[model samples]
Target: MDIVFTVLILLLAVSVSGIAIRLLPFSLPLPLVQIAIGAFLAWPALGLHVTFDPDIFMMLFIPPLLFADGWRIPKREFYMARRSILMLALGLVFMTVLAVGYFVHALVPAISLPVAFALAAVLSPTDAVALSGIVGKGKIPGRLMHILEGEALMNDASGLVALKFAIAAAMTGVFSLRDASISFVIIALGGLLVGAAVSWLFSFASTHLLNLNEEGDPAPGVVMTLLIPFAAYLIAERFELSGILAAVAAGMMMNYTSVANAGPASTRIRAGTTWSMIEFVFNGMVFILLGLQFPHILGRALLDAHETSDVQVGLLIGYIAAVAVALYAMRFVWVWLLRWFASRGATKHGVANAVPGLRTATVTTVAGVRGAVTLAGVLSLPEVLKNGAPLPGRDLAIFIASGVILVSLLVAVVTLPFLLHGWRKHKDPHAAEETLARTMAAQAAIRAIDDVHETESADLDESAAAYAADVTARVMDLYRRRLASLDDEQESRDLARRAESLEFTMKLAAMRAERKTLLALRNSRTINDETLNKLMREVDLSETALTARRK
Candidate 1:
């Protein structure tokens, strides 16, 4: 009963957070709002306390979110930014581990080198989700955002893997550079292969065994998709591989699978809606969970430090500030070097102004906000060593990690807006490709309609054929007008667009009327509830399609 009540409370909190953001006068990030709500709920008067379990939290929330990101992120952009992504995700992660790790130990002499490395490793993974939440959609430049997204997708695994080795070294008091390097390679590659293979196998089963291609209920296939991330994660872990990579790989693999491409339209629609909801709920819960944990972690640590000495409280805070600064500094330098090198190569190829800008570097550095993964990794550190004695600095490390996460978030919240002001006013880079796609699709649709019209009219009577021809012309005219809107001539395009706008208005009005009449019939008992619902669904779908096209 307690577990069920807690789950319900979390879900309710997620829903309420969404509403609260809209009610507020000023614009705030949704994650921030959710966190605030969580902290409020955790007030002593409210008496809401939830245990934070790192392993369960990772298993439950990480996979699906990562999978969704992989599935939705543009494959073309990901491929193009592969080099930069690898440089950030792999190179920068290791660099931060080494540089920031040493810096942490030097700053706080009580922390062991191994534990410091573990702290740095956890802090290495940036929370692109948090960044996205801070800067709403399309606020960042498309190319930069894609690179950031790709980096985030890949680094979670790399950072966690580093932490694993760091933890092992701390436990055994033995570390081997060569063996760890080899093991990392195997873990990463194996996870990727396993994930891709699992996605392929699911696709095969859905098509050949499940027969999802045929007209039938799509719920089973959609449910299976929900399970894919969990399956991939668990299977990869069972093999002692990188489950995070496995989940990411499975999501990326979804793009190339028959299940994604060849599935029925209904299946696609259902799956898209289901996944969207899942992502929202899971994301909200994760942030809320963080908020729930923060008060206790920070409060308890500060209280303990204050009991010892007021100066100790300041020292703890200084540790967090120093670590956060070190992370940002390391990230800035690494990014600057990467861009400087890229600029040199670009200049050799005659590209102008390829050098890195201070703003760009700073934005990238600030965007590296630590999130749930960092907290989870840090908290997962073992409490006891081989001799069963307490692990030194464990509490302090958790406090520092939590503090850094909050500080990074707060920093980004404060600075990112100023930096991103007027960024969205820039012309969309993909506008031309979008227009081209629309023009081609409209032309192809017309051709298909014409072909079907001819086949249907071949053996018909003259009157019937005339009616079919008229219907075909009416249908094809829609596409013809759409094509005209895409024309190079500004006057023709403007006229077509006005006509489209007028048509959209009329269609929307008509759908609303249909819905109104359906509801009236239901109220008057002139139609059964089932009949009204059937007709209402049709009207609703039409309105959705019409409104979507207008947008």
Candidate 2:
């Protein structure tokens, strides 16, 4: 299919998956369902063949995903879970590659050790986007969620880097541990430096533009925010560094620099809506695309039957199974040990809350699913070696990788709900933790509102200042009332929630009225298109806030 038609198909798939997410029973994950749809669509009988080109995949897919992940990671929570994240992302990744690599080589004698390592590396990193479905709907612990997110964010770089070196060794017939280790550090650190620098440059430009357009359009800053990851990735890749790391670093830098935060409320809200759309399309499509590759892998493996040895063909299934089993087995052992050590000197509740027990460790192990990265890595395998012969076992590697990915995703889909279901059965369904979080957020909001008087806006005009102060006072009063009534009384809490919702409805009416006025003025030619768009977006921002509450 042509590129445009391919994109349309993916977008359609994403839209269908989104609708299915709301419609389907809670037990089914949208990714798995969407992938199944794609598999049927891409079957040989259907003739909808979409080629998997690695460079295009890298350029179009990876950067924004990594950047979005880095941007969305809660900074405070990431820091709190940093230790566990590092152990999983770096230590567990290395162990899985070694252990799985050796086991796969042992199982399939035709697969070289380096090629086996490449397959292992390809399958190492978990897809954060795939697992997000489980964490979003399920009541997983907060620390566990953060570590899972944090590990996914970083482990992609580690796994890809390992894959690259292993591929090089496979092609060149030479391998050096010390040189590979040193080069890995260089690539990682260099990517970080480049990413941070590019992010800063973009932030500086965005901030200046926002300042210039304080009372005007914010399109400049919005455009720049969208470009930061692309620029960072391209620049890093040009310098032979890790583009994934570069994109991730740039995202975190944008968060730290407050580039997005510095924009006007309307701009920030609009940008968020745009990002949500991008993430939905990209995330939903990746899994489907991964599934689309299955037919090709199976086809190629069948085609290789006559060329490769009987042993190679015979061992493919066993190798795939061995690799998939080894991944979880190693992960379970590593996490269980780590959890036990971390639980020491900590309370039973606290430790379990953070790391949980053997059951949860098993759940977490299953959830480390391989998806797009694994497919992309194996698909990028060289077609021919330096000696001009076809790369041995390329089809086998792709087949093995696809099988492992599918198995891992299947395991996660089958196991997560049952595991988390049992875990939640023992806990209070009406969680107190959520209420505590709400109260703390409201307290912080009130504190910020209290400081508004010191701003320049408070000194501009008496009426406006008084209006602001009055609004803040009323909001603070609602929060105080809500706080005082948190006595495990469901009726009182529900009443407060309804009151808040009513307030939002009333505010939404004002925003709609403002929007109508702007439209009227624009129709009369009293305001130009630029001013109209700006004012309309501001109204839309307020409307967005209120609409969220109404929902």
Candidate 3:
């Protein structure tokens, strides 16, 4: 009890420090900072000790973290990057396995091919959460960041799938390409079908049976969204299917079916808030847990490292370095190939949005830093081998993986800031300044118009005065919103720009409706031709005013 309390206090202090540092102007890698703090606590004099249970760790951490990532991923952006995302998520994992496995076997002959493959498969999964927590706080482009996030979300399931196969081959002394291929297909396909069906059914029920308005209470809707991924995953896994694929499919389905169908205001905001909290707690716990376990893992590995004969400590380090470098290089190659493929799609449309550019590709490639899932798979390996023998080089493998993680941590912490710094320096600085000025000008213009309307409204007839007051109120509201957004002038300008586009679209639709109504009125002789002509002129003038403003 005392130990638990002490650990909790330590976590609280570290978390507070992390938040405080972030609150400052300068940025640092939050995970690396937390890791350092935990490590410092674990130093002999501080004496922070806690029991480590892998099962407890997974049970407590994995589902919420995975679900939150799945939930928070923007549905639209994910779909936009879906083509490259799928290739990176599925095809890239296979490529990584073969590349890392081939290299490891060729470089380290003492380690059996299957074991090396296990290492490869385990290390292939990247931690998007970790990368985002570290690097994403900076000025990376939204499109590029989304692509990396998409890849991270999907590749997790892919890496796990590969790990399962590699572990099976290592344990059973069997490596059948045909069987593995068939199993992967079946599991992947089956999981997707199950997830899609379940997601569709749930969404349908929520929309139809529930007397839910888009602006109504969101707690129930939020809870339902939280449950879908895990339920989908477990149900599919029970049927001998891919739980990971099921989770992904369910997430995609929820985004496409439920979230997209939701109205823009309260429903979306509520769902976003719920997912945000889940993401925060889950991410905090995962990093803290990872840091806490490191000392114990290192101690155990050191004890067993001395007995390992298959690979020396030096060779293991070399292998880890080689794998890390190879994995990074492979990511660059794969991303380039995917960009080429995605570009073909974009060329068909001739738009920037449809195709990601070179900078986006580079950022995506570098963002793939391996984290928890990799360690999970490596540590999950059997401590004892076949025929009553202890697993050869198991400790060495863990140590190598740890070294790789350390390398990855260092690279992510150091390189991410540089990347962010460079991007911020190059990307749209002046545009923001210009936009801010325009938004302020627009707000001032609106305010002036409102003041004139209110003054004129005083002497008007009741109906005219009420109408003028209503218009004035609306104009004032818009100006107020614009003023509220004045802190970030460029961001406000972007909003105004988008709002202007939406306003144009709405006006166009309204003009068409008005034209139809006027034609009907003329045909019915309810309104005269002169009145129709005047209405047409007013609408045309309104259109011109909007067009001039846009210019």
Candidate 4:
């Protein structure tokens, strides 16, 4: 217990310092730095000892992080970029598994193809948390970032699904193609349905129960919001379904169902706070875990390397490298193909009707960096086979995955900045707007000035009201005329964007007003805190859902 406490304190300090370092102008990957810190601790001189449970890694880190990413992913952008997301999520993962697995088996004739495929599946998708951290740092356009986000968010499930199948085949010593296909379908569909249902139910419950005014009333609702992702995941997993898909579906349902029904102002405030907390805790845990595990995994790999031949080591390295490369190459090719098809249709409709240039596609490919989950899966690979037999090439497999992760992160963090800058210089106006839209936006300075003064009460205080009226009149007249003067499409879009922002702000204000009234009644001892909290949560969920869509 003392050791755990000390380790946690040191880990937290390292994470905090890493964050501070990242905010600096110098180009450094925070995760890489954290990993370096871990290695320093593990050095013989420092002699730090720490251990993390494999089950804890899966349960604690994976679900919430994945769920949070899924929850925040805007539905509108996802739909617009569906073709690319699907190709990357499903097609790329499947292809990488096959390509990586085949190459590994060919290079090292000792291990069975199924086990090799298991390793391949583990290496399939780039880490969303890692990608988000690195790409979020770069000045990439909004649309391409979302497309990359969607791919990373969705592919976690697909990669995991493929891995489960591979593991089953390896463990059972047999696999049926038809059965695997059927199971995959079932898992994916089941997770989706369960997630959607759970999220909807929670959203429904929250909306009716929230009473905004009662003291301490919002706490229960916050707890409920936190639980939804885990509940959705666990329920699906219990039925042998895809927990990842369930969490994703739940997130989507929360976005669409809750947001559509939420109060604009209070909901956004609450959801934003909740999401911010979720992001902080989950991200902190993930990166820290990544760092902490480095020495352990490296030690295992070194131990494995001792018994393995140099040829075998080279083969394993080449195989995982190939897997990472294959995933990137597929992204580029798929994006090019999709854009070509979109362009063909655009020729009839006009080239302007097509999707953005191949540059965005290239940027997406460069953003693929593997992180914690890939490492966890590789490390979780058992050291011993069935019947007390030694598992051939376990260490080599871990070493390869580690190399893939390191290389991918280095490439993404270093090169993404240049790629994004180039894309920014060659910006497409429409694509840029679509990409950079704020998820939880405030109203424009002018529109906000208009709305606040418009609502001032003339009856309550005449002098105050008169002053507000005068100010509002001048502001509106000046802005309305100034905005009316612009004729260009870009100018129109800028105004339209402002108007949209004002609309959501107004909606949020209205919802909060209603919530205030409901809470006043509750404060009169008419309603329980639990009921009030539930409703508040629903309202918050709704607001979050709506805000995410705009972004």
How many clashes in each candidate?
A: 0, 0, 0, 10
Candidate 2 TM-score to native: 0.82
lDDT per residue, candidate 1, 276-382, as tens digits? 99989999998999999999999988999899999999989999999998998899999999989999999999999888888888888988888999999999999
**Model 3, 1-551: lDDT tens per residue?**
89678668655855665686668688667777666666655666766765556445544456557656665677877888887677888888899888888887787776667777878887777787788767654466776777777877777767777777877777778888888888888988898888777778778877776634455676776678778777777788789787666766776676667544664345665677677766665566566656766776665665455578536545555777887898888888888877777678777887665654666666666678777677777887787767777766666667667767768878877776665665544555446877678677877788689679968987999999988888888877766655644545688767765775787789888887988899899999999999999898777767666676555
Candidate 2 Cα deviation (angstroms), residue 296: 1.6
Candidate 3 or 1, higher lDDT? 1
Clashing pairs in 3: none
- Residue 165, candidate 2: Cα error in Å is 1.4
Tens digits of lDDT, candidate 4, 28-57 = 655666666656666667556566565567
TM-score of each: 0.98, 0.82, 0.70, 0.74
Question: Per TM-score, what order, best first?
Answer: 1, 2, 4, 3
Query: Which regions of candidate 4 deviate over 4 angstroms?
Result: 3-7, 22-25, 44-47, 210-216, 258-267, 303-361, 383-386, 424-551
Which residue pairs clash within candidate 2? none
Candidate order by lDDT, decreasing, is 1, 2, 3, 4
Model 3 root-mean-square deviation: 14.3
Best by TM-score: 1
**lDDT (Cα atoms) of all candidates against the true structure:** 0.93, 0.81, 0.72, 0.71
Residue-level lDDT for 158 in candidate 1: 94
* Clashing pairs in model 4, backbone N/Cα/C closer than 3 A: 142-435, 143-435, 209-535, 210-535, 210-536, 211-532, 258-542, 259-542, 264-508, 265-508
Candidate 3 Cα deviation (angstroms), residue 250: 2.7
Local error of candidate 2 at 366, Å? 0.5
Q: Per-candidate RMSD vs. true structure?
A: 1.1, 5.2, 14.3, 8.9
